[model samples]
Target: MTSQAITPSHGLYREALPKGCIVFSSSEGRAIFREALEAGHMRCYFKMAEQFSTQTELTFCGLTTLVMILNALKVDPGKTWKKPWRWYDDNMLYNCVSMPMIKEIGISFDQFVSLVMLNSLIIKSERVDELASIETFRDHVTRLSRQDDHFIALSYSRKSLGQTGDGHFSPVGGYHPDRDLVLVMDTARFKYPPHWVPLTAIWEAMKPVDETTGKSFQTEIRIKRTQYFK
Candidate 1:
């Protein structure tokens, strides 16, 4: 369902949780990394906010994830053009797509793919109508993490991640095979922080149908690039 379809009981369309509430630890920042090491999952790693430029706007999660992935891969967006072009700038992205468009009609899988391709990133994506099983989802995430890549999960925040929103996008930073939990590095840092949630929870969240396409949301995998944007 689209964000517009959601009927908020109290007039607030979305729910927000304070940082550290989800993970509940004094060392909330290091908890995911420490747990990943203990569980023998792929070593937890991701670029921090300082590594990339992003606006503090609420609806730019998809764009934020795109910038995060690009920065993580060492693709200098600012230098990708002959002249200084901050194409990856959040404002540029928001202006390109428009805030009203994003709010009324969420970003489509094809639109997201085109955005990444425009930046010269190699991306492969698929839409799974039914997740099938937790093991299937777990294996997919684990494999990606092992290969030093991350999956951009398009999920219903309320259904899948226990958040209070319709659809959201974030990168899976790490996977804990033993605990059956996955680290969701949410780009909406102003509202929610990165946290480890049950793998099953994410799988369910991804199963919802997109109102725009009448099909399920998509999961995007970024492959190692052999060439960079000039």
Candidate 2:
């Protein structure tokens, strides 16, 4: 995978992944995750896949990203949506951050944290700047991606990854240790597909300050929450 520098669309609907990036739908990308799955590096991938979904609105990246992670972790929203079942949904996630506000512009790291915690979900969010170093971000994700109890999501400047738009969020499906690639399961399905990006590239992408949030980008994980029941 050559590091081809190009401007990629944040929601690259029909755009191609950069040279070094591996498209998740492509055979090569699938094969890489398949190998990792067998190696026990993809436990969280299966859980995430079961609840994967596209953002309902153009600017609902954060809302979309959290919904997937919340459902993946199987955290019951503690409220019935259709009756007899309690599940997390995008609309159900705006308690702390209103849907109107999120649609106007995505949420910042702090906003995301409040929503997650308010929902009773445990989280560990670390901004790129606050981390010991980029390596710290890399190591944390590497471990989280391998486990089943928790899942990771990143809030970063889309432009840093050579993508269009502005700040965006998505979950990490798995990690390919040998190649040092992280699977980004972008929730904005209308634009981009799941892809494998170098770990360091993802780290660098998180270093930019979010003009909307007035803070540097960060990565967050939902530590497994209360078990769900019908």
Candidate 2 runs further than 4 Å off = 1-13, 220-222, 226-230
lDDT tens readout by residue for model 2, 1-230 = 88987876774336666677788879998899888777767878888999999889888787888888788777778799778878877777777767788788767778788887787677776666553476667677767777877878877777878876768888888898888888898987777788998888887887888876677777554455654311
Inter-residue clash pairs, candidate 2? 10-164, 11-191, 12-191, 13-191
- In candidate 1, what are the lDDT values of residues 1-230, reduced to their tens digit? 65666555764332455322255233753675677766666542444334433335656667777776766666666543435554455544543466778755656666767777777577766666554555656666777665543434444444455566666777667776766667777776655556677776666676778776787766444434445211
Top candidate when judged by TM-score against the true structure: 2
lDDT of 1 at 220: 40
Once model 2 is optimally superposed onto the true structure by TM-score, how far is the C-alpha of residue 179 displaced, in angstroms? 0.3
lDDT of 1 at 140: 69
* Candidate topping lDDT: 2
